[model samples]
Target: MSVSPGIDRTTLRTTVAVLVGGIAVILDSTIVSVALHQLAQDLDVGVSTIQWVSTAYLLALGVVMPTVGWLQSRLGAKRLWLAALTVFLLGSVLCSFAWNADSLIAFRVVQGVGGGAMLPLMTTIVMQAAGGHNLGKLMSVVALPTAIGPILGPVIGGLILGVGDWRWLFWVNVPLCVAGILLAWRLIPADEPGRRVRLDIVGLLLLSPALVGLLFGLSNVAREGGFGHPDVLLPLVGGALLLTAFVLWALRRGGEALVDLAVLRSRPTWSATALLFLTGASLYGAMLLLPLYWQQVRGTDALGAGLLLIPQGVGSLVSRVVAARLLDKVSPRTVAVAGFALVGVATVPFALAGADTPIWLLLAALLVRGLGMGMVVIPLMAVAFVGLERPEVPHASILTRIAQQVGGSVGVALLAVILATAATSKGSITSAFDIAFWCATGFTALAVLLAFALPSRVGLDASAGGGTPATGAPPGPAADATEVGKRASIAS
Candidate 1:
């Protein structure tokens, strides 16, 4: 597949600017995770109450994400990005000054609104600028936060709380946000808002509540009883029904729909979307498991848990350069398959980790696991856009992102249930960890299976300009739809 020729200096600066913004959003997510305990004490609230520090943000994020496609079309990418940065910055300041639990949760909502829009916008900006050819490498740079945040967030949060207060977590976002806003204004090119700018108000209403209900339901299940409780069952069933209704509605609207379900007619897109979900479950599920093991099982403090995770981040960083270079040369199928296999292998040691497991051994396991994560991230991200038209990138981003986010919510819930169940047994902490690790392994294996859905080749005649395909080219439904179905059938 052709890489887009090197970008001009101006566009390069813009890309960097957008990447900085993307990193800021990632950093926020991880940084807050470490500060939950401190925030709870500061506000004199229970863990459950302070938990909304993250939950509120997540809820707002879910509510806002579906609107990104509509907003970008209405406001243009640059304007939307700058507006998001400005809002995020203000939210950070408000959070820093929050006096109580209720107030902090309120500010987090503001932060979420902006943060939710940031991710899709980030993907849209870089992908559009790259114009498709060198996507693997471009995505590597764009995906740096996935590698960086898990390593940096906990360490930074620990240090901040160590030196000052939990408020520092919010303060940390200040300089980053300021830098992001200035860079975005200076670097991002202006785009004319497209003519087809009608907002999908109906779809947004349906999708938003559906996502919120689903996440809320999962969080409930994570808390105590399973979905047997009315609280969980109501939202879970309602969310499912709402999502089903929206799918039916989206199918009827077709091209004019909010999500553009038509894109799934492409076999590669469908496979990539599935892989994204599994990756989220495998990766984020591990993320949830590791820190808890460190803090609860190994008796490490938050800082120590964060520090142990650094090795994994290092491995991920190392893999990025290699993965980016190899992406265009080899099929994503091969690269992604290898990546998930490595990830599954890395989890074996953790599956057997005991109370006295050596630090060096654990770090070694993390290094390899991190490497696997890097492998999965770059290829998965790049492949999603491989055969997509430029105009379709936003649609693809929304679909894959929704899959990953929902997957993460489900993953955390799954781990919660596993931990709760294992805790009830007479098994040692090591035995419990073994169980969670096995689940993580299974998830990675599923991702490996899903990778086969990706095309085995890079360049295809399906799209043009290595970026946007010809406008009037028949949609995938008209092009080998049966063949696509055959591939899925064969794989299953």
Candidate 2:
């Protein structure tokens, strides 16, 4: 059957199948944040020990992400997706049966292995299937988990904790994974196995540890004595050195590296990556602050704070269709600039407001913040792949995913440091939150500046009758693959 110029039935089914699995991963990521205290109490572990439940998951995720492109190439999309889903299902079941903090943390790492691969692989498969047409609309569909996860994850966690045992948290994922695996088997097309690609062992050694070190160091900022602590400084510095080594190594290996480093040369690719970093810091860093602000300053409980944040989620949801249309009609630059500016403006109220600022006003600001986030994130994600060929899309997805993940970690750490330093003084929690919001505002402001570097319109080589090579006239195969692969690998 001939597919439409836009999304087709097969595409929609593929997207849905991917999203079903994707949602489970997303929810699991955030849902456990609220359960730390409960888990600590239940397991008879200190807060510090129980916290590894989240930390171990994050570190495992960072370690696994760099391997996804190679793994996908080795296994094909359908097999990889089912394997990841099954691993997650197994991990979730193991976690539910954990008898101690040590066991749970180990189980969480297992879950992270599955989740880390699923994150980038989801995008790789979807975009490859879409063949790079109607990206703006497709991205809106892809972004649904990210938009709702922050707002709803905590609420769901709270509800689960409110009624049932802590183990139910992991148990919830069982049904989702089961359903996801069954649906994927029924819906996703099978791929013919390709020739085995040798794993980039040396590059993997350098890059995976680099990511682990960096994420571990960043995760310690709030708990350790800020950047000055040896615990934080050693890993952060070590990670940086390893990452530098990996870059040099990848450059030397060229297309053969675990992650292709050549994609950074593309103006659109690098620019979108930079913007995604800032967006991550702004979105996630602010998320760290918002719930705490309500709970600490306003004295709302966890569930209440989550409920209050629903306006932001609602705003994001409402704006998706409109933002998708705008992306199709206007330049991504225009939409992104406007979106970041809106985010900056919306954040100013939180930065300047007093503790007693009206509830309705804060909620309204959240709505606008959500709207701007939708606008900024959708286009930034779509623009990253605007001009790329099919094979390169997987690498680009991995690159963008890494950018956003690292960005969120950095953002959270920076704000955490700021809040910690500010809180030590004899001022109220409100002042600390205000200062953090100002810092977040600074991030959006920077993103607005960077968005100018994004492609002014959709598609690479638009003048040459823009579309994927599959849709338009194909380019010279050898030259196009080499260049595209280089850039895509670099970006990944």
Candidate 3:
């Protein structure tokens, strides 16, 4: 009944049920990306308008992420999760039937609202169920969807497009949601109606807009004027200001604020958050470029690029077993440092590669990149939950989740600007890609240094955090941005 230390039947069952539901949310993020062109053409909408199909979903995620912890307190895990999943199922059905770009965009927002809750809630539910033992192994299992969704979604989307229509994208989620709903209802232990925690309307107002500003700002970077454009600059500035205000409010409000800042007092949690940002850049910023590099420079189609990227996903899959085992013996610091180093070293091929750089070599490098990414991510995700009490799990999840999500957005946006400027100044697209890849390497390099700051192993700082609501200093890193530029997967 136990898969490993502390992994019992209930824990394993919970993980499976959560992942089944979560995968629908994660896959839907990237599956629609490749179908944008098709949707635009079919709907008789401009590419710019059709793009909202993705953008509205992304912005919805950004807005909803911070409120998850509060919502969990109000609804209890079982009830909240089902409500969110059902909402996503309804949104998916609505999306398939959408008659116009406007309707589709609205439907996507509905899906994002459900999805935004599920990812963070997935972590909280499983970690709470496990009670914080054998985290490395558990995280490897928990994070599988994040590892596979973005990589495989495009390939699935391409094939669906080849054989069917774009609406099939939403239709695909129907079965998964139904299965997830049934499994959850049967397997998950039900809880009493949750506590009567008051909603922090003021904090919600400040934090939601702040996240929206940041995500919206970053999303605008790929448009004209790059980072300098008002769309990009204004939101960045406004989000930063509002985020600052929210932190000050949370400090005063203590645990009553929409998201309690006390969990960040733990060194491991905060430090891992910062490194996750860099890893976000390494994971997502590079993802943005890799497929484009192949498509534009090597003249491959979307499907071909997705196929070539699979080795990287495979490497991540391969590393999970090794990473889980290593975490049992080695320090998270050692595992993370080595992982970042390998990721940095592996990125060299892409940075130095020319147009004709052998396909096999690039694929080989991708495999290594995936391996390193897996190693880095496993520890980063697991280390945050160390020593925390069950109640605080949601708070920690929100902190780490938001950090990576924001980080991914920042990473994707930064590289987009860097690539655009470099192309203009260097007058060579490949050279620009090279420069951007080096910047990504620089992210891993920084992450390596930050990884050293993580607790050498789990429980080293458990006494300090003690997993209480008011334990740590105010939160430091937010939104280790996940999703592709689709907010990427923080999987934290």
Candidate 4:
């Protein structure tokens, strides 16, 4: 079979398999937001206690993410993927049966451990199989769940709660998990394991807690005292200290470290990390504002607000092919700059909108915004791996994931603070949303400036056997072996 300019048939199949499993994780992330209230009431716990169901999951995700590279190295991708799927499935079943908030929170942590590994590993395995080619196209496929999750998660959650019990939220993952495992077993190739690879225990110790503390602090920004609250300040400060220690420790350990801080030396890698941070802030921060703007200022219900967000999702889906084509033809820098610029321009309407602004106009802007976001995100994710080697791909994935996650948390916290402060001073809901949106626009505008640092071309040689550099040049011995395996799999 002939391959397209980007993804081939084998790569497409692999992407589908991973995405099928990944959809449950993506859906679960946002689906629970709408159910928090229902869960609080059903479980007979305070909203604060029920909130931990989400918090514990996030904390577990942070703890497990940095350990993925080490785990993959020891277990190999196929084995690790299967193991994580099973764990997540088990967690889902346990969560479905939880009789109280504590049990649910514990089960959710198990789910997070599985999800945290799966999220980045999904990209790692695919990029490895693709031989470093057609990343833009591949990412467009990978990004589908991310783009749709926020839009559809709440709707699905609401529907489940509307007619059925809250436990259905966890139960919903069972079929997807089972199917993902069966497909993975049948399709994904087995590889030689790094049996001699040793875990970086010190790095894991420092990095995991560091991420947990930081996320814990950021998660509390919505409480009564905001960032000044004791809950927020203590964890933030402690997390900062732990993170500082990890940086120093990782730097000292060099390539032997759990995360391989040395990967930042690659210009494309670091630039992508920076852009991911900004994009996360822009994407998630805006998400926080858009929903509230509709419900609070426009006086719509949650379901109504979710329906209105559909245009944005539609626009995102529409742009995937175009953006992927552009990335392959034009270059990541060009695509990313244009994307962020479009997003910045599109956000102006929201920044200036009043309480009575026309819904049609707002929806139109959201469509444009979604298109821009698609362009921005796909290229950034693709380029992060462009110049990296096969071994370096895992570290690159972890770094980008961390950047985006932390960036989203920071973005949400900052925007929440801005909204609170503005609402108090102005006593007008519309004005507060306007200010919050302006802050989100600022994030995208800054992202535009950083996008220039991305590679000006897609240089990775997909045809080269073994891990080829993004320079589209001859491959090294290790990359050659890697490429040989990928091609052999494809040919078979």
Number of the top-ranking candidate, with TM-score as the measure: 3
lDDT of each: 0.76, 0.79, 0.80, 0.79
Clashing pairs in 1: 3-133
Off by over 4 Å in 1: 1-10, 460-492
lDDT string, candidate 3, 1-492, tens digits: 446664677778878888898889888877887787788889998755876787788888878888888787777787888999999999999999999999999999999899889878888877766666667888889879878886788899889999998889999999999999998887776764445568899999999999999988887777767778898899999999999999999999987888888878877788887887788767888888888788767889888888889999999988988888898889999999999998999999999998999999999999998999889888888898786666677888887888878888888888877877777778788888898899999988988888889987575224322232221112111221212322211110
lDDT of 1 by residue, 1-492 (tens): 233354445546666898787787888888888777677777899866877777788788889888888787777778888999889989999998998999999999999899888877788777676566566766677778888888898899889999998888888888998899888877777665654557778988899999999877766665546667676789889899889989999999987788888778877778888888888778887888888778767888889988989999999999998788777578888889999999999998888888888979989989998888898888878777766776677778888888888887777667666755665573455676688789889888888887887889865223411333112111111000111111111211
Q: Where in model 2 is the C-alpha error above 4 Å? A: 1-5, 460-492
- Tell me each candidate's TM-score: 0.92, 0.92, 0.93, 0.92
Write model 2 residue lDDT over 277-308, tens digit each, in one string.
88888888888878777877788887888899
Best candidate, lDDT: 3
Worst 10 residues of 2 by lDDT: 476-485
Judged by lDDT against the true structure, how good is candidate 1? 0.76
Q: Over all chains combined, what TM-score does candidate 3 have?
A: 0.93
- Clashing residue pairs, candidate 2? 260-489, 260-490, 261-490, 262-487, 263-487, 399-492
